[model samples]
Target: MKNSDSGARAGALEVREEQDPLLHRLMPSPDPAARFFWMSGADGRLRIEQCDACEYLVHPPSGHCPRCGGDRCTPRPVSGRGTIHSYTVNYQQWFVGQPPYIIVIIDLDEQAGLRLTSNLLDCAPDDVFVGMRVSVRFLARHGVWYPVFVPSQAMESDSA
Candidate 1:
């Protein structure tokens, strides 16, 4: 009998945020901007740009705040609950090991335009759409659970 969860030899969705050889061998990604995003995911916390002075939430991780235009900036935690601002189902593979996936821009509640890119699970790709609600959950790999979301109505307790 052929063993399942095999053959594909491909790893989990985390590979999307894992080490990129061309960027930095020792680091997950050579790109500093992206590294922060992944690192926070590894910690199970969603961080976005924030106003250091007034502590207002911001996005795009800019140096200055749109509220005050102040250079004082800091990273802040997000609720991780959001509606599907927009999303697309990848019918074609842009790279090997990547099957058709849903890339979504989560319109976070309690924050505006603070969209973050993430993979959607627990639902079909075609089922993914704007305004669909989702909640963040972590996908564990090598002990670190990265931020991943799925369709959630209410938190369910695991019996199995």
Candidate 2:
């Protein structure tokens, strides 16, 4: 509501692999409607679309509001705090040289039933739990910001 998304850069994570060719090929390009969600990483914030009519928040950025059929959806910044609704430790090598990682469905604190699928970082795969507290972190590559999550305990320590 306050446009607070841009000013706070503390604890911001930058991956710095802008030249990684593999990432360039792996990450999908954001179209015009979803640009805010992907590009907000430039300022270290996470934004999702909110409906102007019914105030319903939606992800994947549909041009029209899914609930109200309103065309006035706008991107709004979120707190980026959530709980791990579910998760999996992927042991198979989806790509060569890639280590096992935990993928999670985060239930964002913003609204009920609002979830985001993201990779869990900075924690051991075996240590993850279904209700772990996580906060959003950004992985910047080739001008696209990918949202990842880390244990909220680590985030608190980093800030101190």
TM-score of every model versus the real structure: 0.66, 0.85
Candidate 2 lDDT: 0.77
Cα deviation of 112, candidate 2, in Å: 0.3
Which is the leading candidate under lDDT? 2
lDDT (10s digit) by residue, model 2, range 69-122: 999998988878899999988787766866677889999988998999988887
Give lDDT tens digits, candidate 1, residues 1-160.
1112221211122333442211111323345544454556564466666787877677666667888778877776566678888887767655655556677788887666667776676567767777988766555444334566666452222111
Which residue pairs of candidate 1 clash?
Answer: none
Where is the poorest 10-residue window by lDDT in model 1?
1-10
In terms of lDDT, model 1 sits at 0.58
The clash tally of candidate 2 reads 0
Off by over 4 Å in 2: 1-11, 15-25
- Best by TM-score, which number? 2
